[model samples]
Target: MSQEVRGVIARGKGAPVEVATIVVPDPGPGEAVVRVQACGVCHTDLHYREGGINDDFPFLLGHEAAGIVEQVGAGVTDVEPGDFVVLNWRAVCGNCRACRRGKPWYCFATHNAAQKMTLTDGTELSPALGIGAFVEKTLVHAGQCTKVDPAARPAAVGLLGCGVMAGLGAAVNTGGVTRGDSVAVIGCGGVGDGAVAGAALAGATTIIAVDTDPRKLEWAKGFGATHTVNARETDPVEAIRELTGGHGADVVIEAVGRPETWQQAFYARDLAGTVVLVGVPTPEMKMPDLPLLDVFGRGGALKSSWYGDCLPSRDFPMLTSLYLQGRLDLDAFVSEEIGLDQVEDAFGKMHHGDVLRSVVIF
Candidate 1:
């Protein structure tokens, strides 16, 4: 039997989201229904509401979430009823070429629930990032549920479902930050701080955080940044270089998606140092022109991270454990918790740059 639950929905572009009745179907083969405990309001959800992602109007918003598995459909073994899990967008497909090469994190064909979630009137909803979670209960492919420590707080650990995970993976997985390496993260938002925390966890000796906002830079310090650079006051490229003994950092992470910031990241790393782009840019933005000679002279990898290049199955559990052990401060990321009805208000807070994350608690 299908269940009707309250969910946040953006009925059209530029329209304020509202709590509406959504129909959540029973898990079919390879699917599962999750009783969402907490869901974070992400910029991506706002993008969907603003029609920035596509014409997928009537978008079921929210993705970063933690929940309990209400039920599992037949043929599903990855998760079962009563299990505590964090919802993730990327559910790796084993048969993909990337998976075959042992890089399942790069699986080209990620999984989403095959069945459509709909409004009470039977209008189909486009789930944001294939996992609409700003609801009391939601449906997803079984692989999208990654089991984690039940003891962890849903509001905190749920963040690993998206932005937090992306930032950490950008530093540890994509940038290959290591002990003794000097890492400079541009943009001190949630994603940038995640990189700062990741670099700290990886034992990077120096973690420099750069941002235009002083408050965000202070937040980065809480996440383990050793130094903060005010990009508006100083040139980030030169500052990072000076901090690294005139050689720039070993890894420079661009958490701001603008072309101008990316250009700074390019020149803020030492020779052969990696530059990882974790920030998202608009479709209309073009890559800045670069001297081919400079690219050749740098002699290092330039990479764009997709969801922090994370494998949910592997990273979620490990990160959850780290959170439990007190080494990772996931709780610091949650600026406040709101009810589902306040999602529209939360979106407004997102624009003010005052909150790191506004989460919806069931």
Candidate 2:
């Protein structure tokens, strides 16, 4: 059966997203209909509204989400009705060349619902990142529904579906942060704070938080940052070197996708330390010039972390359990709980860096 649900949609570029009635179809083959409990407003949703990603107008926005499985289509064995799950965009296909190489994180192909979801006027809607959950109910591939510990709060745990997971994965998985390691994270946004928390959880001794915003730096402290570097007040690269005995950190995670921050991350690492770029840079942005000899002199890896190198099946469940155990401070990420109507206001606050995440709860 088709269902009419209230959802947020971006009709065109640079236009405000509208609350509209979207016709969500029943689960098709390999898809599941999720009764969304909560969804987080992320920068990607705003990117969709601005047409920064692509010209997929009438896009159903909001992907960082969690919900209960309401129905599963044919051959969907991963989840069943009544299961609590976090929606993930990456539904890795096991047969991809990357997966065949035993690195499913680099899976060349990911899956989404084969069928189309449309607006009330019958306009086909592109689900943001292929798993929009701002609506009361959404249809997505079963692989997108990662079953997790039901005890975790929907709004808090759902964040793992995107930014939080990306940040954490950037540090633990991509950066390979380890105990006694000195780590620095640039851009103390939700994702940056997640990297800070991930570093702390991984036993990093000195987790430096870098950002111009004092409020965000404070927020990062709550997430386990041992040192806070206000980039506006001091030269972050030199400060990082001073903090780490003039050598810099063992791992530096660039959570701000700007060329300046990327360059800061490049120079703010130890001689053989890793640099992880998890921030999404705009196409107009070009890499800054640096000495090629320095690149060769640095003996460690400089990697780009896509979705924090997340494996939904493995990471989501483990993160959920950690949250339940009171180890991962998921609740700290939720700055406010709001109804669907407040999404636009939430975006405004997000733009001002006034809130970490304003979650929409159904």
Candidate 3:
């Protein structure tokens, strides 16, 4: 039987999302219904509302989430009812060429629930990032649910579902910010701060956070940034080099996703240093024009981190454990908690940089 529940959806472009009656069906084979406990209001949800992602209207907008498994369909042996799990969009297909090459993190084909949840009027709803989590209950592919420590805080660990994971993975897994390295992160939002934290976790001795907002710069400090550069007040590239004793940072992560910021990241690194682009850019946005020589001259890697090149099964559990050990401060990323009705308002706060993350708590 299909059950009626409340969920937030974007009915049209630039329209304010509303709490509507959603008809969720029973899990089909290889699918599971999750009783959403906590879901973070990520910026991607706002993009879906703005029609930035696609023309798919009535998008079920919420992805960064955690929940308890309420039911699992046949062949869903990886997770079962009563398990606490964090949902991820990257449900890797082990047979993809990327996985065949031993890099499942770059899985070419990810999994999403085959069945569609619909509005009461029978309008098919598109789940945001394939996880549509702003509802009381949601259906997802079994592989999308990764079990974690049940005792962990849902609101905190749930962040691994998106932004936080992207930023942290950009630094550790993609940029390879290891011990004694000097790192710089641009755009100190939830994702940038995650990079700062990841650099710290990996023992980067000098971590510099660059952002237009002084408040965000300060937040970066709490995540173990050794220095903060307000881009509005100074030339960030020059400042980064100055702070590193006339040598640029060993690794620079661009979390802003703008070409201008990418240019800044490109120039702010030491010679042959890595530059990781973790920020999501609009489809129309193009790269800054750089001389072909510059690309060739920069002897190191220039990589784009998709979900920080993370393997959910390998990373979700480990990061959750670190959070449990008090070594990773996931709670610091959550600025406030709001009800589902407040999601629209949270989008406003996010636009004005008022909060790091406003999570929806069930």
Candidate 4:
């Protein structure tokens, strides 16, 4: 049997997402149905609505989410009914080459529910990031559900499903930020602030946050930034070097996903320091022209972080525990709680930088 549920969907290119009656099929083998408790409004969701991701029209828009397992199909023992889980887009397949090599974070063969969720007239809907939760219920592979502590707030911890995880992992996992290191994060948005918090958690001695907005820089401080640089007022690279004893930071995270910011990150790091690019760049944007010799001259690792190079099964539970212990302020990421119908309005607020995350609560 199929269940009719209310879900937000983008019908066409650059069209406003609408709440529609979606037909959600029951969990099939290796799958589970989740009763979504909370889902975050992320920029990727808006990108799908604007047709930036693909021409997969009528996309079920929302991925960063947390929920309870309402039902499980055969062979789905990792999570059972009533288990609190964070939905991850990456559902690693153990047989994949990346997973066989023990680097499941780069797993190339991830899984999703084989069954498709659709509209009333039987039109197939593309679930954003392979796990759409901007609805009352969603179906996903059992591996996509990372069970976490139930004590944590859904609206807050749910962010670990995507952007937050990407930011923190960019610093901790990809950049290898360590004790007494100096770290600089560009564009203090949700992802950049996550990097700031991750750097702080890793015991970075000096964490510099760079952003054009004073308000965002202030928010960065709450995430444990040691210093804030208003990029509008000064050259970020020079300012970061000045703050780091005339030597650039050991690690620089570029979260803006623009060529200009990427250049800033490249120049803001020490000779042998690491640079992590966690931002998602658009297809039309091209890399800025730079001297080829600089790439070889800089002797440091330049890495692109896909979902922060994170292994959801390992990171989500640990981060949630930190949140529960008051060690990680995940709650700070939730700027507001909203309803499903308000997602369009939340998109506007997000564009204007009015909120860090507007989560829909069921």
The residue ranges of model 2 lying beyond 4 angstroms of the native Cα positions read none
Q: Candidate 4, residues 72-119: lDDT per residue as tens digits?
A: 999988999999999999999999999999899999999999999999
Give the TM-score of each candidate: 0.99, 0.99, 0.99, 0.99
User: Lowest-lDDT window of 10 residues in candidate 3?
Assistant: 292-301
For model 1 the TM-score comes to 0.99
Worst 10 residues of 4 by lDDT: 282-291
Q: Which stretches of candidate 1 lie over 4 Å from their true place?
A: none
Better of 1 and 2 by lDDT: 1
CA RMSD (A), model 3? 0.7
Q: How many backbone clashes does candidate 1 have?
A: 0
How many clashing residue pairs are found in candidate 4?
A: 0
Q: How accurate is candidate 2 locally (lDDT)?
A: 0.94
Residues 1-362, model 2: lDDT tens digits: 89999999888898887899989888988999999999999998998888788997889999999999999999999899999999998999999899999999888899999988898778999999999888999999999999998999999999999999999999999999999999999999989999999999999999999999999999999999999999999999999999999999999999999998999999999999999999888768898898999999988889999999999999999999999999999999999999998899999999999999999999
On residues 307-360, what C-alpha lDDT tens digit does candidate 1 reach at each position?
A: 999999999999999999999999999999999999988888888788889999
Question: Lowest lDDT 10-mer window, candidate 2?
Answer: 49-58
**Model 4: CA > 4 A from native:** none
